[model samples]
Target: MTYTIRQAVAADLPLLADIERAAGALFADANIGEVDVDDVAELRLIESVARAGGVFVAVKDDAPVGFILAAPLDIHIHIYELSVHPAHGRQGLGRRLVDAVCDDASARGFKAVTLSTFRDVPWNAPFYASCGFRILDPAEWTPAFYLAHYHEADMGLPLERRCFMRKELK
Candidate 1:
């Protein structure tokens, strides 16, 4: 199936939330952490991201099947989230979204793209590694990373299983 990758729009926010819910459901089968089916980007947040040109979506047959939310942080493009409906999983949607973001970031002078994911999840850190991302050592973390870690800890996420990754765009 062919999918089109484009900047997300205000009207696409609701569909993005649906896609996120479907994607998050996959983690429930993983049996790790609390899988909140409602754990999704809020409409206003998605609107703001769309307005800032920081959100991208994958559309299949005119329906959104995935989305990637990103922001500029620590002089790099930080992917806040990337979720695709499970029905569309393993079809390279994630990589396509990441590549589009990375290309945009590189053209905008960002040195790298960074994100955090489960350390052992086959489709998390390992999948990112296959896409040219490498695990970032704790000693090499930026100040923003420090704060992000603190926030994640406070949220009661599995910090021990979290792995920060970076893909240098140069």
Candidate 2:
């Protein structure tokens, strides 16, 4: 049950992508239309985050079971991706990853953490709600956050099913 949270390294990019694939499978039965397991995180992006210390991995038994990637977008820390292998689900790895990102954001003087997820997915929006993220009103959205809705829609993810959420850092 013990896991270590540490900055991701060069060797973890592929493993993180693998974990992303396994975690994305959980959406298969959510009836969210489709599950694109092949759309895992790209190695270059992962490597960039890893090099910049914006990525963290939950390691158990010397293997990465989960990872979270964050980036500074405008005035906030945007959680670009968070994925935990299905086998590690419900073990709090995801929350821990979010906390890790939040800590880094605080260190960087960011005011909030932001992310987007499917509102109807049991483990997506609801889980984030439990973590103190509330749905962001359009008026509250930064230009990038506002445009992300259309970007997602253009990518085939219905706008109505997805939403941006924010958690203020205090």
Per model, how many backbone clashes are there?
Answer: 0, 0
Tell me the deviation in Å of residue 93 in model 2. 0.5
Compose the digit string of candidate 1's lDDT tens values, residues 1-170: 99999888767788887888888888887757787889677888877766657899889988889989988878888998999999998899999999989988898888999998888888899989999999999998999999999988987788999978999998
Candidate 2 C-alpha lDDT tens digits along 31-106: 8777689898788888877776789999998799999999877788888899999898889999999999988888
Which ranges in model 1 have alpha carbons more than 4 Å from their true place? Answer: none
Q: Cα RMSD (Å) per model?
A: 1.1, 1.1
